[model samples]
Every structure is written in structure tokens, then in C-alpha cells.
Target chain A: MTKYKINLILALVFHLKLISQNFNFDSDIKISEEFRYFFNDPSFQGQEDFFPSYSLTPKFNIKFNDNNIIFRGFFRHDKDIRRTHVDLREFYYQTSISQYDFSIGYHQVFWGVVESNNLVDIINQNDAVESPFGNDKLGQPLSKFTYSSKNTGIFSFFLMPFHRKIVFPGKKARFRFPVVLNRNFIKYEKNNKKLKKDFAFRWNHYFDIVDIGLSYFNGNGREPIFNRNTFMAFYPMISQFGLDLQLTFETFLFKFEGIKRTADLQSFYAQVVGLEYTLNNVNGNGLDIGMISEYSYDDRGALAVNSLQNDVFIGTRFNWNDFSGTSLLVGLLSDIKYNSQSFSCDFSRRFKEVYKINLEFQYFLNIDSRELLLPFFINDHFFKIELSQFF
Target chain B: MKKIIVILLLIQTLNLFSQSNEKLGFEIAQKAVLMDQGFKSLSTKLKMTLKNRNGQTSERLLENKILEQVEDGDFSLIIFNTPKDVKGTATLTYTHKIGPDDQWLFLPAVNRVKRISSSNKSGPFMGSEFSFEDLASAELEKYSYKFIAEKDEFKIVEAYPVDEKSGYSKRVVYYNSKKNYRVEKVEFYDRKGDHLKTLRYEKFNLYKEKFWRADVFIMKNHQTNKETVLEFSDWNFDVNFSRDDFTQEALKKAGN
Candidate 1:
């Protein structure tokens, strides 16, 4: 405790010294209006056939010498539950001196190589309410230390003293589970709570055409087990080892991500491997076309909580490489063990410099009972459109 | 015997003249590259304006950092500044004189740095008339050259890219022979050996009393009737950039 107090005093003095110096600052804001229309009525009575919402994200940054402080926030207003919430996307102070760097605050870190699904990226929880596609992330509060080796690789250590619990979408949400898990019935291990200390270490390097990363995380697992009948969720303590690799050769990129974990509830292994290849100037035009194929596997197969167990993903991407930055991606994900298939299309373009338009479509051709909420998603096929303005 | 000797002498003179032209062309290219050495590092911002056939225009802004490697190739990083949706995106490239370059792109929204194929760099950059190949540092060994002509203050050279994957079949370059051998104009021929585009460099800046860099580049495509103008600013040679700043770890912070 005495040492901790001394460190704090020293850090305070350091900050005070920089406080008198000149600082450069800048800020940006993004406002987006989103509307989603479901082709069919939601299976649940409380859900809606269409959902509309808006979000605002504001970011501010300040820098002096090699030190930087950044703050970013996300706020959304929706007619549905769970969708209307505020999140701290990032609030951190970072500085780099020579071969070492340090940062401490709430942040988001993504760690994976495969595009279809990520099994090794466990640093941030999914902001499910923001997007059912699972790209939105909730910031994690942690302290990070990074060191670059002269001839080896980069090493990073993270200390997370608190866990941000995942929130389930409210009953009125379009893609909500049949029943919402009651907080009163949720279960946690004896020492499990928000204060659970988590630690993670990762080492990554680029060797010519190949890049590889290895990581170890010891703490509560980010993905929880659902007690379907009990209408509850359980958090388990687990240790996970992850590896991600990518090889770029010619016009092709090969990717792989895998993780093995030992948990109080159960132990399992999961992996995802994929490749993307681009054909530039396909027909003497500026347009470029690409293809992506990935395979995901889990030890628990259909029983896995993650929707991608034993699944194959195929996607096609078209890039106009034009002035307006128009791009489109159409993908299909299917589970071999359960025979579930989901097709999606994403399109985005920029216009008028500061504005962008995005469109997305999701359709479920079939859903196996083993896929959990996917069966109810047949009625959730929807089209979404978003317009964003940046300043 | 006298007539035969005269013919032999004439042939010998022609052969020597052709050989000298080739040798002079290569020598001028070497001089151009050598004069810019020892700058160590450079940082600049580029404002790119693209004009379509319809006479409409769009603009993009990006910042660039280049680290010169004495023995190998230069490492360059470009961070996009504007065109709104692409703001905060960054791309890094390691270019070699003889082979394909290595490239990586950083997407700020996801905070992900992904390695991308560099072979496709021959495509247009930001839908502009300039392709990635057009913007790369002119390495002496990447092309084979022959002297075309010397008119007034400039000497012209015709060159062919050694990497067959290049978008152009040939290029005619004109350099100001009186001043630092700086490139003045270039004409590019497409893969079909048809005239494609022409680039003109104007308004040169001399930095550190040794390096001469062009402040403006205008490229016009004949077939597409498209034009692109690039203006460079904020030229800084001493930001203390190191190899460490070019790594994947540093790419994550490039947006900031």
C-alpha cells in the first residue's frame, strides 16, 4: 500500500509537469440515423416489425510530446429496450518512450486474424444492442503495457480489475431471446463479481509474409453459458490460450484464429480459418472483386453457445475503388452440424464529403433448433438503412 | 580500301553514339536518386483533387511519412485526413526496387491493422488518375532506360518497368538537366501500348539545401478523360521518426 501511494504521487507530479506545457487538441462528432424493417412480424408479441434509432459519437483528443489523452463516447436513442444506452467507447491516456509504451483507462482491443468470426479476441464484450452482426464493441477498463523487442516481437500485458457484464437485449428488441434472463436468477462463481481481476499477455510479430500472435488470458470467460430452462446466465472462471496467424501471398490472404480454454463449467476448443483473394481490374474497369471462405469448428459442435460452431462462411466483396468509396459485401454462413443458414448483404457509400449511406440485409434461409435464437430469427429477416454525418 | 575504311568508321561512330545515349540516360537517373540521399526522413501532407470526364470533382487529404533505408527500401505510411468516411484510415507500405512491395491498411472504426496484397497496387488510388505505382518513389533499378532526346533544359528518357505486373508498358520521362536532374514531365503508355496518361511536376521546393521535391503533381488520363491534381504541404524532415513507428503496433495509434 505504501508503494502504491508513492507511485501515485510520482505519477501526479509527472502529469503536473506536463500540465504547464502546450497541448494540441482536436475533436470530431458523428451522428447516424438507422432504421430497420423486418419482412415478417417478430415471433414474440413484445417485439416490433420495424425498429428505428439514432446514435451520436463524439471524440476529443489532446497531445503533448509523446503523450496523448483521448475520450470518446456513444449514445443512442431507440424505441426499443436495451437499444437505448450510453457507452464509453474509449477514455485513455497513452504515451510511448523509446521501445516501451503504456496506457491505462477504458478501451477496446481487437485481436484476431480471421474475418468471418473471431475466437481469440476476448478483450471487449459485444455491444449486442448496437448491432446483431456482432461488430460493435463495449470498452473494457484496463491498464496496458507494451514493449517492442529489437529483433523478436511486440509484447503486451493487460490488467483488467473489473469486468463489464454483457447486457441482453430487452424484450421489445427485434432479435431478443424468447425470454430475457432475470438478474435475480443469474449465477456467478464464489469469487465472481465486477471486481474480478483479469490478466492477459500477448506476443505478436510479422515475419516477411506471415504474421502470428500468441496470447494467454486468465480470468472470467467473456462468453457465458445460458441456462435456457432456468432463464438465467452463468459466469465461469476460465483460462484461455489463443493463437492467430495470417499469411499474405500475391493476391491472397490466409487467416486463422484458435482458442483453447479450461473453465470451471467446461473445457473446449474452437478455431476459425479463412482466406480472401482479390481480383483487381477484373474487366479493365476500376472495379475489383474478392472472395472469402472460412470454416469454424468447436469441440461442442451444435451445443456451443457461439452461433458459428461447425459452420462455413462464404462472402463476396466488390470494391469500386472509386471517388465516393463505394463497397459491397454479400455473405452466407451455414452450420454443417445443425443445418442452419444465414445470408447477409452489406453496402456503404460516401457522398457530399461529410455524409455516408449504408444499407444492410439479413435473411435466414433455415434455422436448426440447436442454433438457439436463430430459429426465431426466421421472422427477423430485415433490411436496415443508415445515414451518417461527420463533423 | 579507302572506301571500306570510311564505311567502318561511320558504323563505329553510330554504335558509340547509341551506347553513349543509353549510358547517359542511366547516369542521369542515378544522379537524380543520389542527390536526394541523406535526407533520412520526410513528412508531408497531400491534398488530392480528382476530376471526372463530366468535369465534376472530388477531393481527398492524407498525411505521409517516409523513412529512407540506406541499404534496403523506404518505408512509408499514409494516414487519411478527409473525405470524411475515410478519415482516420491509414496505410503502410515497404517498397523495394526489384520486387513487389508489402502493404498494410489500418481501419480506425475497428482498430484493426490488416496486411493487404501489394500486387494490386497498380489500380487507381482513391479513384484518382494516379495509381499506386505512379506515386511510388522512382527507384533507379525498377526500370530499364534509354535516352530519347535532349531539348533545351530537359533530357528525355524512355523506360520500361522490369516488373511485368506494372500497369504501364512504357514511360517517357523528362528531367531538368540544369537543376538537380529533377523530373519535369512523364508520359505513360498502357498495357496495350496505347497512350494513357501524362504527369507534370511543377513548383519545386529545395529542402535542407540538398533535396528537391515537387510541390504539385498533375496527372491527366487521355482514354478516361480524367485528371488528378496533388498538392503537398507541411514538409518536415525531422520529426524523429524511427523504424519503431512503422510497425503494426504503431499503426493502431496512427489514427490519433
Candidate 2:
């Protein structure tokens, strides 16, 4: 342990030396505490978790003449399933030369327009233990080269080396499926050596009122197929093609995202189409309300996880446009084939200059037995509040 | 008969003078827009303080970079630098002279760029007293100018929004009558013709002896009794920027 600590300090010093060579440097640190109140008791024993969790993240950025570097790290200690862990969210060196931009190291890429599901955002693995909603992702290591044109479109290519696997909540956690995911017993459809070298490409352009993107990816699938009891996680070799489109009119936004993936076990297609319409300054009170609706469909029937075979999502976002920076979003997702449904609400407000407060609540209702992973999360509905201070 | 003829001639002269005055108002507005052009690019740091009716205050820091389009409206980027929650957020706007502007917002938390279709341009900017329309670079064709009055050293001009979608009925702009022709103040009237807001430009500093910029701008909303003060500093007009710097892909990296 002493040697490990010494080595860690040495590595940090080396990184500091590399950063000091830059011209201008800026850094920010944030600390947050989250408290969750579970209205429902854990269905099983030993599942009762602590009420509070803590997280600390420090971000650093440096600019060297024409080159830029940014690094962010996250460290969290929780009483529930994840326990304690540290992750490197982003550490990349980027530069733009002429019409091309390049970045090498750990990074994240977000693609697609549909709000309900991001079918084309498959470059990074999900950090499921961070949030039950699956909106968090682990950092991915890749070398990216992008070309942007004034009149045409932007094309980006990524050569990714190494794959990060998704982690699930432990048995002692709440709001998770009953099956305990064993990270050790992972399976790969192809040899690890071959799967390590993955490639992805995307082209995005805007024409008049419409914005569109086409993406192609060949890599180990981000989602793992799990079997019962042993939690046999299988990372299959897959190839995917994706299309995302958005059309913005006067006060309405139309969006669509679709993907076709071929894997070792099954070939499936999925799509989500949505629209958002805003009523600005309703009643002349500086309140803007946006209504959103989306429909999701997957061809893989009940075989797919999360019961996303067919679903409809409806949500509303309200912006007070006040000095407090108040905003609220409420959404609901219902399974078309089953009676399972999920309702969530997120409200946030900025306090003064350095602090922000957020309240989030999610409830899963009427879980049909036919829905996959429903049995374990029967008592996972809860409300959480968090405060973050930035320095 | 001689007296009547003299009166008719007087009326004719008055009519011609009024017509010329209207033409002069348009010419002055056009001249102001033209004089401020050819700067090529400008980058500045801004600090905005928003105060409500109850005197509660909040502040946000932003960095703005503008690249002048040779033939069209300007392309600009605004990056939020302070106010912890909003830090790392940025917005890119491409303003057009003939039509509505294109705007995209980058949210750091989600790491996604959202295309906002806000053609109305009347929404408050970041909950401040200033509206989105006010933040955009002024274009001469957007409004029709009519000479209102001359108060001391300032020439007041009334500008009517030509676009039917404008939330305001008209705007009254005050310009410095001097050769510099910089804006001095502005007053906005709502759709119902009520006085909505008043903006005052203070502490003018001439850069390179040709370009004029205000060091302080204060916008006061009449209806809500709220005010926003924008203080600008660290103006750099020579830092060269290209079209590549204004793309949506560059927004995420703009925090640096």
C-alpha cells in the first residue's frame, strides 16, 4: 500500500509537469452531497442502504499556444451498491489545425436527437451504477480526427483502443434488478485481442431547417446480454448503422434517431421519433413551457432488456427565466406491450453564485412480471435531493 | 391671391422637409451599421449582474467572440465562465440579415448540443432583462428607421420591426450625433405599445481610434422592475478567428 501511494504521487507529479508546460491554466473543483429517501422498504433483507452519498470531482484545463488539454476526475463514496470507486471521466488533448480537429485520449461523444432513447450514442459504455436512468457513461479511450467544412458537413472518425464494460449495482443496492452482476465472469463473442481494436465514424450536416447525421460503428456491443443466476455477461461482436435527424420550425422541434445493429446472437432495429413544442412567456410571466412526446420501437420483442420493445415517452420542461435559474422537467415512460411504467421529475435551482440545488424523483409503477428485470426493482422508487458547491 | 399662393408654397416646403427628414433617419442608421463594420473580429469578457424587484442579485461571467461575415450577418460564440452551475455552457449563434438566426446551446452536464428554434427572438437571455433579440448583432434591415428627435448631442430614431413575428411594436434608439455615430441609448415598446425597457450605454472607449465599444451597459425592464448591468473588459480586436472556430463541434472545447 505504501509503494502504491508513492507511485500514485509520482504519476500525479509527472502529469503536473506536463501541464505546467502550457501557457494559461485554469482549474475548478466541485463537491456534492446527495440524500435519498426511499418511500418503500427494500423487498429483501440486506438491501437497506445509507441515506446519503458524497462525491468530489476536480477538473483541470490548460491551453498551450494552439493546443488544449482538459482533465476531469470523479471520486465517490456511497453506502449502497457501488460502495466506493474512482473514475477518470475525461482526459484529452485536442487541437484544431486548418479545417481539421484532433483529440487523443479518454473522451466522450454524444450522438442522436431523440430524447427518449439515444440509439446512436454507443461509443461509450454505460456507467449504470452512477444513475439508475443510465444517463451516465464511463470514459472511452480513442483517437479522433474530424473534418469540418463551411458549406458541407462535419465528418469524424474514431479509432478506439480498449473497451470499458458496464457495471451493475451489487446485491445490497436498491432500485436494481435482483440478479447480481458478476463482473469477473464476462464473455466475449470474439477473442479479446481482436475486439480491442474498434472503429466508429459519423457525419453530421445541416440543410436549411433540418440537421441530420449518419453514423457507423464496428465494435463490441455496449450492452451485455445476461443470463439468469450466473449473470453470464456476453459482449458480442456487432456492427451498427445509425441515422439521426432534426427539423426545427418556428416554435417546434422534430427529432428522430434510428439504428440497425447486427450481432452474433440477433440482428435488430430500433428507432425513436419525437417532437417538442414551446409556449413562450405564457401569461406574460416569463415562464416558458415546452411539451415533448416521443415513441420508441425495437424489433427484438421481449428478448430485449428494459422492455423497450415498444414505449411512449411524454415530458414537459418549464423554464422560469428568473434570476434564480429555476427549471423543472417532468417525464413519463410507459411500456406499450406491458403495464410497466416509469415517472420521473427533475427540478433544479441555482443559489447565488457557487451553489446549485437539485431535486429528483422517480417511480416505477405497475411492473408486469413479463417485463425483464422487473422483479428485482419492485421497491426501487425513490426521491433524492442534492446540493453541489463549485470552487 | 398672392397671400394664398404663399401659404400653399409654405405647405409644400414643409411636406418636402418632413420627407427628407425620414430619409435622413434611414441614412443615419445605415451609416452607423456601416461605420462599425470591417473590424474583422472582436473578443471580449463580460460580467452580467441581474437584479430583481426585491433587490436580489445574481452574476454571471461570459466570454464572447465574434467573426464578421463578409457578405452576411456575423457569427458569434458566447461561453459561460463563471457561476458554477452554468460554467462550461456555451452558445453559438449565426445571425442572418434577411431571416431568423440559427442558435445552438451546449450543455456541459449532458455533453450535448441542442439546436434551439427561437425565431421570435423575444425570450429573455439567460433570465436576464436583455432579450435574445438584444444580444444578436444589430442589422440595418431588421427594422425601419424614422427620425424621432434630437436631444442635445443625441439623435433619437424610432425603429419599427419589419418582421411580423416581433414581440415589440417599436424600438427607440439614441445615437451619438458626433462623427463616431455610436449608440447611446435604446427604449423598447411592447406589442401593446407600453414602455417595456430602457437600455443605457455608458463609458464609451474608442479602440484603435475607429471602433467604439461601451464599457458598461444597463438594461432596465419597466414592467417587472428588474435590471441587468453588463460590464465588458479585456477587448481584443486583433485576435484572428476563422470559420472553423464558430462550428458546433468546437463549442464543447471552447471552455478552454
Candidate 3:
């Protein structure tokens, strides 16, 4: 108990130092706390079980001249699991000289326009313990260099020296795998002693009507293959090639992203094509409505782990464009093969200037026994609410 | 024969007078664009107050950066500084002489830069009466002008958008008859040919002995019963801006 108390005091002092040290530099800081409660217990848990969690995140940013540095930390405590964990979402230093820019440390990069899922984006590893959905990611450490020109395309090169493994929830947590994963039993295809550096390159350009991006990646795959016998995660060596294109017209935006990957377990291709159209000022009351539709395809069929072989997604976004900045999005994803479907709604609004709230609800309907995601479907539904205050 | 000759001369003189008025009106519009040229760049702070029909008011603060181009329209950046919900949000715009302008928005919460499609230009800006197109610097080629009449010290002129998709069908501008040729008031008509809004400018300030700026500008929406008033101050010109400052990547740091 004494040791824990001392640690807490040290953390408080460190945070105060960071806030006071930016006197001569331009800085921005925000601290937020959130609480999440689940209404239903997992099928594997007893009826008396309860699931609730709380977290605190602090983000710090400082800039000088052309250089920028950012650091974000997350600390969470779960009541049911009775465990505490700390994670670093991002810590990076970036600078630019002339037309060349460089960044080193941990960061996250997102790409793709499809609303259903990400087909080509693979820069960061997923933080599965944070959310049931795969939108959150754990920051990856790397050195990135880029050169941009007006006439020519922007070229980027990434050199990652270390690979971080994924983390799963504890046995008492909900929405987790049926079997508790043993991190000690995990296997790596590459030698741990040797510097098995990963490499990637991308080129992006924009024209009057269309924008294009081409990328090639040779590294450890983000998705882990679970060995049923050992209950362990195995990351294999993989090489991937991806292409993304977007065409912007008057009121329509068409987007497409496709990727082909070769891995130790299987080699396959996947693609997502979609478009979004907006009805501006629908009633001339400062309101806008946007409709989005997309189709996802994977050549692996039933062999796909996520079971997203053939699926269709339809969604609509409403922007009130009012003083509170209220927006709501509702989407449905339906599987063509098994007839399984999932519905989700996301709503967010700002109360005044400093306070905001976000609400998300997800429900899964109909599960075929042959589906690979049957375990997740058993626990079918969850709702989450987050209220944040910015400083 | 003398009476017929006098009537023929009168008709010819009226035709010449109308022709010169058209030429003079266009020349004056062109002069307004030229007078504001060679400013190199400008930086200013903005305070905006919005009021609803119930008389409730909200305020916002912003910083603006503008860089004049050699041949293109202009490059400008706007960063929200207050209303903590939107603080550190920035937008970078590259206005062009023709075709659609390029716009990008940076969201600090998501740490993402999104390329906004050109169609959203007609949408209101930050829930204010001013649309995105209204806040942008006016380009002469984007609209065609015609002189309507002269009243007192103001010249009334009508302008129409070249693009049919524009939100406004036509706008009547009241230009100051002074040599500076500043805009005093504007009346906006919606695409359905209904008068939608009116803007009034006040407290004109002359800078560099050549550029004219309005310290107070108010926009009243007749349909929505809401109004927005913008006050500008702390004007700084020629702040040594470069093309690098206008890029999408630079938008993340624009708030600083």
C-alpha cells in the first residue's frame, strides 16, 4: 500500500511539471476521464457478475519553430477484473525542413474512407481491450520520412525497429475470447535478438478530380492467429500491397480501397468500395443530410476470421449545424452469406464550450452456428456513454 | 425638319449615356479588386457574437491568416481560438480563379486532416449567418456585375454567380461612391429568388493608405430570425508568410 501511494504521488508531481515547463513554448493540454458500464454479463460468466471500468487520459503537446512533440497517456481501472493497466497512446517528435518531414517515436495513422471497416490501413496494432469494435489502436514506434512536392506525388518511407504484441482482457472481463490468452505461450516468426526491422513505402497524389494512393508494406501482420491447442497468439511475416482512390464531384464523393496480402497462414485479397452523397440545406433550415453505402468483399469466404467475407453497409449522417454542434450517425451491416446483421448508432453533442458527451449503442442479430464470430454474437449487445471536459 | 433632328440627337445621347454607365460600373468593380492587391499578407483577430430570436447570445474568437498569390486567387487559413469545444480546430483554403476551391479541415480531437468536398462551401460557417463562400475573399471572375442606380453617395449594383449551383441567385451590393470603393451593404437572394439575408458594414478603417477594412460587420438572416455580428481588430500585414504556411499539414499548428 505504501509503495502504491508513493507511485501515485510521483505521477501527480510529474504531471504538474509537464504543465509548468511550457512557459517559453507553445503548448496545449487536455485531461479527460470516462466511465463505462455494461448491462449484460457474458454467457461464460455467472449471473451475479458485474462489469464496469473507468479511465483517465491526459494529452500534452508542445511546439517550437517547426518542431512538434506530443504525448498521451491512458490509465484504466476495472472493478470486475480488479486490475490496473497503463498505456501510451502516442509519444512522437516531428519536424519539417523544406519539403521533407520526419517523425520518430510512437504514433498512429489512419487511412480509408469506407464506413464499415478499414481494408488498407495497417500502420498501428489494434487495442482490443479498449473496445469491442476495432476502431481503437495501440501506438506503434517507428521512424517516418516524407517528401512532398506540388507537381509530383508525396512519397513516404517507414522503418519500424520493434513490433508490439496485442493485449487481451482478463478472465473476468466481458466481450473477451472464450479462452484466456497466455502471453507467455505466444510465438514470433522472426528471431528476437536480431534487428528484424520492418519497412513500408507509400506514394500519394491529388488531381483536380481524383486522389490516389499506392502503398507497400513488409512487416509483421497486425492480426494474430490463435493456436487452439496452446491458446497462444502467433504473428506471422506478411507482405501487403494496397491501393486507395477517391473522386470528388459536385455533391458526391466516391471512394475505393483494396489490399492484397501474402502471409504464412493464407494469402488473399479484400476490397471496399463506397460513396457518400450530401443533400445540402435540405429544408434551408441549416441542416444537412448525408447518405453512405459500401460493399465489402474478401476472397477467403468462410475461412475469414472476422467473417466479413461478403457484407453490405448502409448508413446515414445528420448534421444539425446548430449551436451545440449535434450530429448523429446510424449504420447497419448485413452479411450476404449467413444473413447475420449488426446495427450501431453514434451520437455526439457539446453542451457549452468545455463539456461534451458521446453515446454509442451496438446490437448484433441472428448468429449462424457455422459463423466464425459465434462467440462474440452470444454476448450480442452493449451501450456506452462518455462525458468529457476539456481544459 | 428641325424638330425631327432634335429628337434624333436626344435618342443618340441617351444611348451613349447608358453605354458609359455600364462601362463605368464595371471599371469601378475592377478598381475595388485592384486597390486591395499587393497587400502581400494579412493577419487579424476576430470576435463573433451570434444572437437568436429569444435574444440569447453566444460568442466565438478566431485568428485568420491570408497570403496573396501572384496569379491565383489567394491562400488563407482560419483557426478557432475560443469556444473551448472548437479550440485548436483549423481550416486551410486555397481559393482559385475558376473551378472549385480546395479546402481542408483539421480536427484536434481525432488528430486528422479531412479534405472537404467543394459542395459544402454553401453551408453556414460555424452556425453563423455567414456561409463559407461569404467569408472567402471575393474573386472578380466568380461573378458578373451590372450597375443598377446611384443613390446619394452609394452606388447600387447587382452581381450574379457564374456557377448555377451557388446558394445565392443574385446579390445587390451598395458600394461607397468614394475613391476607395468600399462595400457598404449587401442584400442576398436565395436560389429560389427570395431575399434571404442582409449584411451591413460600418466603421471603415484605411490601412497602408490604400487598403480599406470594416471594423464591424453584421449579417441578419430574414428567414431564420438569427443574426451574427463580426468585429475585426489587431491587423498585421506582411508577416512573412510562405507557401509552406498554407499547406494542409501546416493547419495542425495554425492555432499556435
Candidate 4:
């Protein structure tokens, strides 16, 4: 059975574990200034159209005698009081002994192969105050052990003793619903406590043209369902099995990610599948353009926490192949059932050696009647411009 | 009578060498490859400067780690060090002998690794005159060659790329026969066999008393009037590197 195969591989990983020694030290810092503007007036009371913010991120690393210590910090000052905060993104120590590596502290890792939405990535909780799309995550505190086999695959195990809850935008924020949720009212299904320990395992392998990963996770669900009347969030306990795969050949790349979960309340699945084809040297020029199309499906339907359920995404990415590393990505998502639509455009360019300018625009139109995603209270369309200096 | 005898011997050797020009070219290339083999592993830092037609220049800094595979092509990892905007960004490449190479790009901000298709070799690399195909053609088996000419210390050979995706139709290499067959210069011809670019290798250093590496490389684009100067420094071969150091898991750790 599959369980036997997994057990056998786990045993082999512990037995066939190798040696490396090196020393390196590095440091990096970035300061970013940003301005954001909203398209429409506030749908709620005491909301503003323009806001400004600044942030500083610093990272320091040291590697000595096969052991590495890494530290990263994020601090921000924003006009919105809810967005102003300080966080330790990473502070970890990892060491290698032969083929085995062990690490402990706050860390972050991403899973899944889809470009539009990643349903299989469930390790970290969303920092919705920073980005509603869940592109940003708070660092997780955990301990991990990995066994890497030369010819077979890579096996990894994680143990997390604490859980971080989602942080939503406050009442004055543009994306907030008409009714504000009280954080103190949040409840957990398992003994009404957030200290539940979680565990995960993953097996990743590469075979010439394809790369695949199989993972299992038993943890507190990162997504929560809310009670409309009392404005309370209930976190559920979930057991999930996930698969992510990618096949790359010539100029074509195919990616697929799927996850099946059984929670304390219900059972459901979600999937993202897509293909990307790159056309290099277009018209004898150095410009490279990639065409992408993907579909997202979620069995949770009305209860889904993301807007990508039952939606189709079409996108184009352009790389000018210039010295500045200029790139532009534009995409549109259209709902199949509700006929709602959303568009996003991101453009970034580096200049003057260590400085970069980024522009982002996002718009939502024809919201679903049930409001599966953004709330109906605020005009969520916005554009943001950022100038960053790195040292 | 002795001079006449020496002249005859020299003429006889030259005739024998020219009998099969293709075979002679192959032998010269194979010998060079063999001379540079058995390096085991290498690590170095690289500084690249790009000069535009208007006389402006920009610089990029990166570190390179190479693991020599006996049967397949080498496995290389490139980590960007400066232009701090891209710091901690790394790329892993597993070049093969038969199929296309496997390449991945690691993004540090998101902690994500994306497998990218390596079929677009002809496109320019970071706006530099050198294309990805140009950087990949250093292997002896990637091209077929023919002897063009032989002079005092230089042996000229014409090499045709084996990959259909190559941007150049032919490349002419001038090897320094006196310096263990080290390449001194190369001239590239475009798809129409038009003169495209010229590259010169300078300041060669002998490493491990067996391998010859050029410290300075200058590539000039004839059509675009642009140039790139690549400098290699701090070559370290004493450190140990394992195959496990180049995998996706390692990339994530390295990104951090």
C-alpha cells in the first residue's frame, strides 16, 4: 500500500544520510516608500482615498562550520493604524550532518506550482492587512528535519508548536466589510485554543522532464469561516493531502496543484491547473513573452475563502531582456458561476544600480452577490507606487 | 645537405597534418578539453560590466559554483551578490549531453523556486551582447569544427553549432597553440553568415598547474556597437561541494 511505500522511504532516508564544510557571512537591507490611491469614495464611515507608508527590512546571515544562522526583520509605518507594526520574518539556525539537516526557529517555505493561486501552500497564515490576496505571510515558528538522498528524492518533516491567526484590515481600511470583526471573539474548534501543535511531511523528486511533490499536513486550518451576525471567525482543524507537479519541455511548461482536505466541520478539495508557453526572441528581438491560462476549482463553493474558485485566469508576462531587468505581468480572473471579474497588473524596473520602482494596479468589478471574496462595503479598486532602495 | 633534409621533414609533417582538416580540428579541440578536465570542483566570483553605444556602463556581481559531472554536462549555481535589489537570487542549471538543460530560478522575497524552460538560448542575457547560447557553447561536443588556417602561434578553426536554436551560423576560433591550446580570440557570424561579434580572452592564469583560465574576457558586438567586460576573481578549489548542494532544497536554504 502507499503507506508502506512512504514508511520504507522514510527508513531509507535515515540510513543513507553525507558531508560539507564552508563559511560565509552576508547582510542585506531595504527601505521602501509607497503611496496608494483609491478609485472610488469610501463605502464606509471615516475612510480615506489616499494613504502613505514606509517600511524597512533587514536580513543578516552567517554560515560557519556547516551551520547557518539567519535573521530577518520587517518594520512598517503606515497611515492606517492597523498596518503599522513590527515583525520578525525569520530567525533560524540550521546545521548539516552528512545528508541530514536540522533547523529550528521562525521560517517560511512555499508549496504548489500554479502561478495564479496556490491551494496546496498551507504552512503560514495570511497577513491580510498587507495583501488581501495572501501573497504575504507571517513567519512561522517550527522545527524541521530533512533527509536528502542522492538518486531517490528529498524527504522533509516539520513540527510546529504554535499557530498564527489571520490579521484582517481594520474598519478604516478600503477592503473592510460593513461590520468589523472583534479579534477577541475569534474561536478555535480544538479546545478553543490556538496552541495546537501541527505536523507536515513532504517527498519531492525530479525525473528528467517532470518534477513532483507529495505532501501530507495535519494542522489548524489557516482559512476561517465567519459568523455574519456576531462577526466572529472559527478556525477548524484540517487534515490535508496535496500533490504538485510540473512538466517542462522546450518552451512549454505545464503546472498543476491540488489539495484534498477533511476538516472538523466538512470535507472538500481545491485545484489549480495551468500551462505557460514562452516565445523567445519575438520577431528577431530580445523581448520574451509568456502566455498563460489556468483554471481554478473549489468544492467549498459559497464557503470558499478565496475568489479564485470556479474561475478562469488568463495572463501575459513580458520580459524585455534589458539591463534593468524590466518585467510586466498582467492577468484577469473571471468567475464561471457568478460572472464576476477582477484584473491586476504589476510592473517593476531596477535603476541606478540598487534602487527599484514598482507599480501595481488592481480592480474588482461585478462582485458576487454572496461576496465570496471582497466585502461589498468598500470600493476595493486601488493603485500603489513604490520606490525602494537596497543596501 | 642537412638543411635540405630538415626542410623535407618539416614539409612531410605539414602534409600529413593537412590530410584531413576536420580530423585535425577535432583532435585539437578534444585535446584542449582533456587538458582542462579533472578539475573536480571550482568556485569563483565574477564582475561583469556592460557598455552601451552612448559610452555608459553598468556592473553586475555574481558568485559561481561548479560541479563537474563525468558523464553529463556540469552542474552550476549562480548567486547574485550585488545590485542588492536582486541579492540572494540564485539560479541552478543542470546541463545534459542529450536533452535540454534543467534550469530553475529562485526568488528570495517569496521563498519560491520556479523551474524555467531553457530553450531560449538565442535571447540576449540581461541586455548583454552575449546570448545564453553563446555562454553554453564552451563544451567541446557542442559544435563541429574544421581547420581554417595555421600561423606562427595561432591555429584558426571554424566551428558550427550543433543546436538548431543557436543564433550564430558559424564561429571562427583562434587558438594559441603555444599556450596549451588556449583560445585567444573568437569571431561570431550571424545566421546569414554576417560578421556579428568578436571576443578576446586576456590575462590567462594557470591554475593547479594544469588548467588555463582567462581572468579578463572582452566581448564586442559589431552590429550594436556594445561591449561587455567580464572579470573572474577569487578562484577557490579547496572547498568541498557535494551534489546535494545544488538541489532545490539547498537553493531555498541558500536563498535565506
Say which candidate scores most in TM-score: 1
Backbone collisions counted per model: 0, 0, 0, 2
Q: Candidate 1, which CAPRI tier? A: medium
Candidates 3 and 4 compared by TM-score, better number? 4
Ranking by lDDT: 1, 2, 4, 3
Candidate 3 lDDT tens digits, B1-256:
9999999999999888877776766776787788788888899999999898898888989999999986888999999976776777998887888988877778765566666676666688888899877898789888877788999888887788887767899888888868477888999999899999999998888888888999999999998889999999999886878776676556755642
Pairs with backbone N, CA or C atoms under 3 Å apart (clashes), candidate 2:
none
Q: State model 2's lDDT.
A: 0.84
Candidate 1 lDDT by residue in tens digits, B51-80: 989998888889999988867678888999
The candidates, ranked best first by TM-score, are 1, 2, 4, 3
**Model 2 agreement with the true structure over A1-391: per-residue lDDT tens digits:** 9999999999999878776765788899999999887888887777764568989989998897668888988888888647466888889998878778899988877998877788889898878788856577888999999998757778999999888876767777786655565665577778876666789999998886888999999988887776655656688888999999999997899999999999878799998999999988775656889999999899977666656779999999999887778999999999888888989999999886788899999888778777666667878888899999999
- Candidate 1 local distance difference test against the native: 0.85
lDDT of 3 by residue, A75-185 (tens): 767653423567777788988897788999887776655667777788887776777575777788999998876567578899988787767566666665666555544
Where does the lowest 10-residue lDDT sum fall in candidate 4 chain A? A14-23
Tell me the TM-score of model 3: 0.88
Model 3 pairs in collision: none
- What are the Cα lDDT values of the candidates? 0.85, 0.84, 0.77, 0.84
Per-residue CA lDDT of model 4 for B1-256, tens digit only, reads 9999999999998888775788888878877777778887899999989999998999988888888887888888888877788787888888886668988889998888888898897899777887887766267778898888999999999888888888889999998888888888999999999999999999999988888999998999998899999899999886578898888877776666
Candidate 3 displacement at residue A152 in angstroms:
2.4
Q: Candidate 3, after superposition: displacement of residue A155 in Å? A: 2.4
The runs of at least 3 residues in candidate 3 whose Cα sits more than 4 Å from the true structure, single-residue gaps closed, are A1-41, A46-52, A80-84, A182-186, A226-232, B1-24, B252-256
Q: lDDT tens digits, residues A242-335, model 1?
A: 9999999878899999999998668899999998999987766568899999999998665577678799999999998888889999999988
Give me the displacement of residue B65 in model 1, in angstroms: 0.7
